[model samples]
Target chain A: MTAALGQSARSVLACGEVRTCLLPSFQALDGRAAAQLLRLRADEHVRVSERPTMYALSPEVLTGVDCRLPTSNGSKVRAVGTVIARAALTEGRLLQSTAYFSAPAAGPDTRRPWGQYLVRPGLVEPFGKLPQQATVEGVLRGAGRGELDLGTIAEGLLTQLRRHALLDRRVPFKSRPTHLRWVARRQPEGERASLTNFTVAEGGLRTMELRLPEDVPAAAAAGLCEDLALHDWLLTTVQQMLDNSRIGAADGPSVVEALHPVVVHLLHLWMPRAHVDAALGHLWDVLEEKPGFSRQWEKLSRRIRDRLALQAVTMPHQAFSPR
Target chain B: MLIFAASDKGGTGRSVTSANLAYHRALAGDDVCYLDFDFGSPTAVAVFDVADAREAAEDRGLHAYLIGEVSEPERIDVWAKTEHQVLRDPPPGCGRLVLMPGDVSGGEFATTDDNLRRCVDLLMKLYHEFDLVIVDLSAGRSYAVDMALEATAQPEMSELTARWLVFHRWTRQHVAAAASLVFGRRGIVAGGVHRGHDEEALRGAIRFVRAAVPDPESPLWSQVSPTQSAWMRKTDGDLKQLASTAGIGYSQVLGSVPLEPVLQWREQLITDEDVLDSQIANQETWTALSRLAARLTDDKYWEEA
Candidate 1:
């Protein structure tokens, strides 16, 4: 899906994948260090915003792919262009890297020069006619072997940032990474963006479908998905911690130890739409209606607080007797 | 924890034993990733019973990754992809088991600065994601070992814990070679120290594993004549003294694996089925592997002598 720059004749679909994980560092980085850690490109600027939360975003890096686009109908459209990868640090604790590109409806039958595609940044022009619906489904299903893999590109960037000399390579907690795959179909101009579907698949994979207005940039849609993925990861990680601890089955001290990291690093970072574009922020309402992300987060956070309080109240006697 | 499995020579069962350690760790609820850094002969796929790894490695394997040919290596989830009958059905609460195979045709290459950086990045990422990251290096003082030493000695990996295991067989030459591989000139200790690793700390992290040991008292050897049995026992005692003198003494040894027909012949993982249903592998070998696997993470076993 090509970002609508008014130069591209028509943009059909935009797709992206966001990989979220805990930064492997014993102590959270400050704003300067976060920016230093995320400086992917030397020339481009690394955006650092601290109004709502401490967030540092790296300049985008490009990966070239000349492979067949995955299509549900098995249509053969060999796209050749660059996929954009960028790293984002939220509160210096949670880190996310996104790889996204937009594909136009159609292009010349033959291949173009690599330099021609480099100018477009995050656009992969398809060969011949493109079936938008089938391509969207194909992307969500994931690329076949030897196809353009956005997840791998994003993960590669994440791995690169994680190996920076600035990092200590020590994680405060053991938490699994989460991946969110998102696709947005272009709507008519002046139409409000809307959410189509949100699926929580097994194995830490989440799928998001949206009807984006034609004017919205692909980067903004990526931002919305990254925001959703970060909070979703927080909720999933905390819930898993609770489940693994066996709160009711296990004793008090163990439960408190399990939930400690949640309070330290995750609790205050739950501001949804903090970085999402205003036009696409409404899409979050659809997710809030059913399996409410914020509601569950609050419930889990409160449970942790109550347990900590209870332990504080009973610690004097229990500490003396346990020894 | 990152465990580097190395050996002074080939045919030491280093790859199979290390793969088994990774498998055992995953079975015990610790997420594990085993990387096949054996660039010359990438045979880890056979050990895990992943049939299509040769093809997959051709597409995008660890070789492609380290050499900058591919951005990311293809990781095969052992449980989902393995053709092994028992590993197909993952037991409840078992953690993830992943294998990062090397390119089938990836011959040995000298280490460059970029290659070293890539190696560090791969190990650091795996270290963050998995509870145990077992990297099976090629035998002797190869480029793979040099790259591993340089990668772990980097500043980014300073906070991470890394250990080394040198595998050798039960023979005079093997014992002497294993000792020299660690303490001799141009050995792991020397190489790591040359690459910024603390000499004492690196020494503490290195341990020796004696593979293919034979117990004369076992029933398999009971059929021998009295003189043969006596000779076998005396030889074993002499080998112990030789090993101690070589500097890989009792304290430095992590564990020993008894010689089993399965490991020697098939060169495959000796699963529980081999002991119970198949009856192809000896129970003593299984128990020894289990004990070695347990001692891998047990602090008491790793304490510096």
Candidate 2:
């Protein structure tokens, strides 16, 4: 069923948006709670994995849209189909939701029955020939007014999960959410998938472009982007915390108090490619080589540890001093 | 934390004062979202001076989002979009200030199930992303207030903290009407209880802001004759006594904004530039707004009286 719906369409373009943030619960959820939180449908079973890391993924849900496709040029193309959205929790601390859809090169000019669209999830059928380049640019740039908006769908899912009864609705620390918008253009079946461009813009926006083989499903691309977005959010949040800590200006105990959340919740979450499929795991190599994500994370981890150690050594003297 | 700003009358300075509170909170390094829930008359766009967003939000504002016309409402970044020369450049280390304007053509409508659900979803989303969410409601007993009460009563929102501030001018009629609006029959407390809110808890969460109050000791009023001065002091004392009898005494009052000519002439934020450089707005007004903003989340001020 997955192959029939996700791969048999010979999709020419794939686009998605991933929103990542810390789960708003004071305590991290266990596997049972994580699975319950990500249960998007009653009848469908949520996929839970615990091999390399604890992770739970919700079953795919569909949002139907019959609106103008975002185009870089002034051309207006109305598309009618369903967009797929799913939620995933990593280590019960970070929650992510992705809304994505794939499109074929062209489709029938008339609309089909909603039942027909429901049968094939995550496929948005354009009325006519899909302007592959314009749509790609448009998705990266973001949807315009009255356009197909994947961010809204993803945010809606996130909001739904955060309101689950199991959650305590309290977070240890406050941090902003990050949004990663990505588009993948299909190459020949024999070509290898490669990351083309990644730009980090202001206001927690990140855009990624990729070229993937035709045999690879769009769901895999979404998975790869989700992984990237999750790590990016971790780095961004920790960096913000450190910047706000005022280490040199503030006293030692206060700085330690500020960085305690990172040490407790985020340091152990840096296992890259832990949940990604092996075929798409190579995409992390480019990011690993130039501006090493793990390297920066390790340095940050060391700084936090050294501060804690120093504070421990000086505890006796500080305790003896006058308040 | 969610703060709902409601007023009993139209000229109570509810929208402008709440917008300023939102501004002050953002300047104090808390990411704040100001929602224009005054569906009948959406004037926050003009107050924030975001002319560009005024056009974009005409069709895709909170009204459209609540009515299912749009999936998401348009959010205008006040610091980036405000045409005010002083607000254009925010101080470093300050947090974000976002304004979710109302539709230009939006009007008051009865609450529906779908609308209530959408309102809950929007509030939950904002609560997660923002450190403080200030919702400016329409005046008097309106659909906006009803929706707010219904949405907060939902089980999903029970875990979040929601507070209300009823604004009124410093007049005997205004004070009496404000108290009745919250404590009278079919008032907020009664309506909240009907919607499944605990009466004591809802009453505890509600506070009042007395706007446009004239102080007899201020220089602006010192030019009056001795008879006028005595009469002013006597009226102020009588009003205070009347407020106490009306059940909205000194303890229930959050803060009061002095009568400033600038706030009367123009409904805009009282920035330091206005007080220091331009010399158009009063320093006392700025200080009062700052203190009120700080007290919005202060536990000491919000405890049961």
Q: TM-score of candidate 2's chain B against its reference? A: 0.99
Q: How many clashes (backbone atoms < 3 Å, residues ≥3 apart in a chain or on different chains) does model 2 have?
A: 0
Evaluate residue A158 in candidate 1 and report its C-alpha lDDT on the 0 to 100 scale: 86
TM-scores of the models, in the order given: 0.88, 0.93
Candidate 2 regions off by >4 Å? A1-8, A42-44, A112-120, A245-256, A302-323
lDDT of 2 by residue, B105-196 (tens): 89998899999989998887688778899999999999999999999999878878999999999999999999999998989999999999
Question: What's the true lDDT of residue A304 in model 2?
Answer: 75
Candidate No. with top DockQ: 2
Q: Backbone clash tally for model 1?
A: 4
Alpha-carbon deviation at A77 in model 2, angstroms: 2.3
Candidate 1 on B137-157: residue-level lDDT in tens? 999999999999999998878
**Candidate with best lDDT:** 2
Q: For residues A11-123, write the lDDT of model 2, one tens digit per residue.
A: 89999999999898989988998989998899999888887889999999989999989899968999989999999999999999999999988877888799978877898
